[model samples]
Target: MKVVLLQDVAGHGKKGDVVNVSDGYARNVLIAKKWGLEATPKNLNDLKLRTKNEAKLAAEHLAAAREMAEAMKSWKVETAIKTGENGKVFGSVSSREIADEVKKQYDQDLDKKKIILEEPIRSLGMHEIKVKLHPQVTAILRVHVGEA
Candidate 1:
């Protein structure tokens, strides 16, 4: 049976790809879950239109990500964490705290999942953090950790 995938299917094909699948897969799995539709003449045409619309939306999203990346490139966020006399933080800073601070400062609500820290900030110093805007769009941000 032939089907048009509505989303990426592992080991088979990606969204918008028309593929020949087993009858069981088409009837029991894909169709039942609304992950795909049977490839009829009208369905294929509709899938093409849907795919085109999705591509346009994806391009727009990519453009917006790029713009946000450029803006974030100039960002340097300062954080004050309680530290000891030896300059070690009592508690390490997490990505959620930094994401919240970013939102507080710039009014940009970034996903905590998109922030990447190689290691927790445990000392008072300047550091660099990476923000994953998209699979390809990334920005390095400057962070200054001060003792509070």
Candidate 2:
């Protein structure tokens, strides 16, 4: 018996996959448990259409991420830090501060979690920050840190 999996079944197949199993198992374990549906002609066609729509939506999301990365290259955010005598830095700059500064300066809302910071900025200079816009897209944002 052929079954279309509604969810992943260990050692069997992933969701949306069609797998062949014994008729007894398909009828008792899969259908009875509501884990899968019988692979009828209508069910197969619906799965095919759903897959096609998902692929199209994924491509559109990737394109939007690429476009945002291109636009972010020219954006610069200004931030400030407190410095002591002899030019000693008092505090470091964080991703949350950078995100807030970008919104305040450029009117662009950016998520702090998307800003990748290996460590907090401790120096006073222009720094390049990596922002993960998507799984496959990364953008560089310039941040100019000066004394407050």
Candidate 3:
């Protein structure tokens, strides 16, 4: 029996794939568990339409990410914090702080986890930070720290 997989199954095919399996297995395991559907004409056509829509959405996301990456390259975030006499910041600046600052200054939302800071900002100076906007896009942002 031929079936269209709704989700991945170990030792078998992935979602959206059509595979032939024993009729008993298809009826008892796949259809009973709602993990797949019979490869009828209607189900196959539905899968085709769904795949097309998903491709279009993915392309739109990639374009948006590219535009954001270009804009981020020329942008800088300025922040001030309390400092000691030796120019060391009283506390460290975290990725959450940077993400909030970006939103406040540029009106752009960013995930804190995407702000790749190998270490927290602990000194007063200009620093470069890497932001992963997408799997294929990375942006560098300038951060300037000054004493408050």
Candidate 4:
């Protein structure tokens, strides 16, 4: 019997995949557990339409990410850090601080986890930060550190 999987089934196939299984197994396990549906003509057509819509949505997300990356190149976020006597830095500026500064300055919300900071900023100057907007898109964000 042919079945259209609603979710991944180990040793069988992934979601939206059509796989042939024993009639008893399809009726008892897949259909009973709601893991899959009978691969009738209507179900197959519905799956095709859903797949097409998902592809179009994915393409739109990629385009938006690319546009954001380009705009971020020209943006500069300013943040402050405490400085001690004799030009010594008191604390470091982390990814969370950078994300907050960007939101405060540019009114753009950014995820701290997406801000790739190998080490905290410890100096007072301009630095280039790498922001991962999407799997295929990375943006360089300029950050200026000043003494608070």
Best-performing candidate as measured by TM-score: 3
Error of 1 at 137 (Å): 0.6
- TM-score quality measure for candidate 2: 0.87
Candidate 2 to native Cα RMSD, angstroms: 1.9
TM-score of 1: 0.81
Q: Is candidate 3 or candidate 4 better by lDDT?
A: 4
Candidate 3 wrongly placed segments (more than 4 Å): none
lDDT of each: 0.88, 0.95, 0.93, 0.94
Deviation from native of the Cα of residue 124 in model 1, angstroms: 1.1
Residue pair clashes in candidate 2: none
Across 1-148, the per-residue lDDT of candidate 4 in tens digits comes to 9999999999999999999999999999999999999999999999999999999999998999899899998898888899989879998999999988888888888999999999999999999999999898899999999999
Expressed as tens digits, the lDDT of each residue in 39-134 for candidate 2 is: 999999998999899999999989998998998999888899999998899989999999999899888888999999999999999999999988
The residue pairs found clashing in candidate 1 are: none
Can you write out model 3's per-residue Cα lDDT over 1-148, one digit (the tens) per residue?
9999999988779999999999999999999999999999999999999999999998998899999999988888999889887776699889999999999999999999999998999888899999998888898999998889
lDDT of 1 by residue, 4-41 (tens): 99999898899889899899989999999999999999
Quote the positional error of residue 77 for candidate 4 in Å: 0.7
- Best-first order by TM-score: 3, 4, 2, 1
For every candidate, C-alpha RMSD to the true structure in Å = 2.7, 1.9, 1.1, 1.5
Q: Which candidate leads the pack in lDDT?
A: 2
Residue pairs clashing in model 4 are: none
